[model samples]
Target: MGQDQDTLSVVALCQSERVLWMPDGSPHSPRFKDRYRSRSGGLAQAMTVFLAGAGLPVGWRGRNRFSVLETGFGLGLNFLCTWAAWEADPQRCERLQFASVEAFPVSAADLVRSARNAGPEDQPECSIALRLPVLAEQLAQVWQGLSPGIHQWRFAGGRVQLTLAVGEVQATLQDLDCQADAVYLDGFSPALNPQMWSAQTLHLVAQHCRPGATLATYTVARSVRERLRQLGFSVEKCPGLPPKRDRLQAVLRP
Candidate 1:
């Protein structure tokens, strides 16, 4: 955490959320009754499903600043992976702004552990796996004092910004002021976390996006696709990462 602003709540609310580690060492949400990321790997899912699906690294290339709006923060592996990718790319955008909303946030310790367990996406010796644990540590340090309702932090000499909105999906989305260049629509399964994928929620998400902005998600539910399509997004079902039959990508038509 480089710089943060507007402390609205205390860490006490963090107790309402509970997380359990799967036997495979992945983080699972007891409340959502789902794993935060694919058991195959967190970094892998972050890179392939969300980042690449949204055309990132490539999408952010040629911009002075890039904004990403993520529906589910989970263990924050996606933000860490995105930051790592930006740092590694020579043609990266000059600044990155990432805003994620989570109804229930896990402990800081889990963030680091999730990063450590997120692997085999690439070689452990020299890949994103090595970088995420260190990045997670930095995130955890800031997370220790985290409360709720819109907290902002800067990383990488202020080149990277994180706006963490903690609350229900729809309300938090409405509260966050972002004209996102890209979006990641991720959370528990639509069957389980229906509100996150509900029509009203997706409508609010679309309202925050810029014209021609791109969106991605790990789910390809029919209702989700239709809801997004109805919202004026050009939705496409794309090849997914392992364990997922298909993922979705979309663009907000101007």
Candidate 2:
């Protein structure tokens, strides 16, 4: 345990996750030509597109452990929202494991900024408004010492843990050894970040999921739907939040 803690500081430096704050306060990825989340709010997207879509909170109830794997970490809004929801849920799983892969991770400051600027000024954050900033601070505290490898951190008295893989998506996912109960397929648009949404990447993602793992994503692209169908996922389009009309939800068949 001591050796493991010592190695957590062995992170080499790499710079990425460049963002241009849009006029509406959304983080825009110039490389991907897409916004991370809309001005509508990151929390809202996490709660609706991901948490609700995956049947979380309810899904994890009564389980001793639940894990979620994500294709793109982005600004980490989804993880935060999920953590907050788990804390609020009376019947949440005993342990919540979240693992995410990000080819280009943002600065620690950006992570906290993203959370602070979560929602529009007119509207408060979706839920956990009071706790969002606090959670962001906790994440930022350990955001330092990140490199092109896995950086695992324990939180909520070790009941909640985040495994952030900082490297190319495929290679990182290959290194990750977690059987996810749910999966979040999030990133820039399929057209923008082809690698993240590619068929081969999706295949690797499937390898990490247990049988009957649930999946949620904010895209209804026909190609994605077809590819997931081929992967033994019962895919369907569900009602989406704007600026999207429909979102995709899938369940891996046993």
Best by TM-score: 1
Q: Give the residue spans of candidate 1 off by over 4 A.
A: 1-12
lDDT of 1 by residue, 12-76 (tens): 34553567887878778766688888866887888988899899889999999999999988889
Among all candidates shown, the one with the greatest lDDT = 1
lDDT of 1: 0.85
**Candidate 2, RMSD to the unseen true structure:** 5.7
TM-score of each: 0.92, 0.92
lDDT of 2 at 183: 98
Residue 111's lDDT within candidate 1 is 84
Per-residue lDDT, model 2, residue 188, is: 77
Off by over 4 Å in 2: 1-13, 120-127
Cα lDDT of model 2 overall? 0.85
